[model samples]
Target: MSKQPASYRPRHAVILAHPNPASFNGLVADAYCDAVRACGHEAIVRDLYALGFDPLLREHERPGTEGFRLSPDVDAELDILRGSDVFILVYPIWFGMPPAMMKGYVDRVLGAGVTSAQVQHRTAETVLRGKRLVGITSSGASKAWLNEQDQMDSLRQLFGRYLLHAFGMKAYEDLHFGETIEGLDQDYVDANLAQVGDRARAICAAIASDRAQGQAVPPAA
Candidate 1:
């Protein structure tokens, strides 16, 4: 497999949001991280469920309050986010959206005074500009059903357009693996896992190409 140049290798923060260790989402996350490391980048995998991340935004954790203060856990996660050049999110679609823990991570860790700055008479200034985000989601429903119900579009809007753009980060692909695990053969599962590895390599290559050309990485379509 081709590797990214040492100078262009980027730091990656991989967030896994599934509760079950034996789930397909966990397999994908492991494959992604392995590919990232194989491509010569540093990959840190955070299993939110395993970490026992609090999915609630308490009043004290609310932004703009005198009592607003991040817990030690949030602080540590924020540090990982800040130190990484790329973010990879692997989760299962729960009610057509990311799980509560992932949403809570956004609310608390990426809240005001951390990943963004408020400016008078304008939108919040995104402090995470120049970073990249990629999301990999799995669903029990068929892709056709998701498309018919517009859940795919909703996912794109929520993660790619709204969330990443809000943070001024480049949205670099969102892969949805639908019809997950139920009645699927091992061959089919292996194929999807291979694709995950391929995507990881592609991400590294894109970043390296951008650096080589001295250009900002373009958002993935």
Candidate 2:
């Protein structure tokens, strides 16, 4: 009798919302997953655009509806997220915000399958609670200019902090690369990818420490 391979319980999830397979966002996603695996931890990748994911939220599917339900896609996404402690989002910022695809993912997947109907429902159950969020985003504008205009801070507040607080996640970290327009320099790309790899290693180390200490993180509100 042949022995089956050991089960894989993914610890990190890398989600990409880039339309082009060869885009920088795709490269970042690949680098992240590879780095996580190199650190001896499992990581799952989800390419929303490549999978033709539906970004629309139908009226009937609204939360607390008479018959609120999640579509098969959302269910699958949630299932993947359930086992993950770290979620890394890779995308290109457009018009000072994440692309529509990423926004849709936030609504359909990160929102979780079901939420309590009443606002201020202090005890609502959420699968994403205690998880950590990291973001790798690129933009056509320069990073200094964006920071000068307070756009980066805006994004950190609106996307990272807001999501962290809303979902009860543990932490939020965002890294941005600017001047990513056409004819971008290869050196810039390499530098950013190196940083991405470094971040993955750091996160993996932290997760390992938590596991070793038998930390119990959950039901955060």
Candidate 3:
């Protein structure tokens, strides 16, 4: 039998979209997963599209009644996700947001008993406390255009604050690449992936080092 760590073992869950292997977003997601593992963390990858996870939030799935029961696949997803100290979202921005598949994963997995709940008239406090989160995204717009449009920057306000902070994520990071529209050169895609992959590794390394030293990993500057 293999030996295990004495007490601590860093665990991470990475969710990805874009099932197309030729897609730049998919390549970046794979690279990030590899980087996380290199940092000695147990990285779990969730490929939303390939998994065929239903994104629709029907009334039957709502919290309450027998309809709230999760399907076997969803239950498996929850199990993998709940074991992590860090959660990573890797996808491409389509029309200024994540794909439908990823959105659905959030709807089902991040629901009641996972993130937060309600108590009568007021909302209750969030769970998923002490967990960290990060995102890696690629978009078609040029960097200048996106900055001018405030797409990536505005996203932080949504996922970082409203979504993640509301659910008690202790840390969050985003790695975004742009100018990936039609006719984009393959060289650019490879270069961007290399840069983002290194960045991911650095971030995870910093976290591991901080934990090893018994200090909190400082947030991105």
TM-score of 2: 0.87
Question: lDDT per residue, candidate 3, 62-151, as tens digits?
Answer: 666555666666677776776577777888888888888877877777654442344332243433456777888878887678888888
Compare candidates 1 and 3 on TM-score and give the better one. Answer: 1
Alpha carbon lDDT at 183, candidate 1: 70
Clashes of each: 0, 0, 0
- Ranking under TM-score, best-scoring first? 2, 1, 3
**What digit string (tens of lDDT, one per residue) describes model 2 on residues 1-221?**
23223453438888899899999888888888889899888888889998898988866567867878888888877877786889888999898899999999887878754465422343335656788899889998899999999999999999998778777788889888888877768998899899989998998888776564554445558
Ranking by lDDT: 2, 1, 3
Residue 199 alpha-carbon offset, candidate 3, angstroms: 2.1
User: Could you tell which candidate, 2 or 3, scores higher by lDDT?
Assistant: 2
Clashing pairs in 1: none
Looking at model 2, the pairs that clash are none
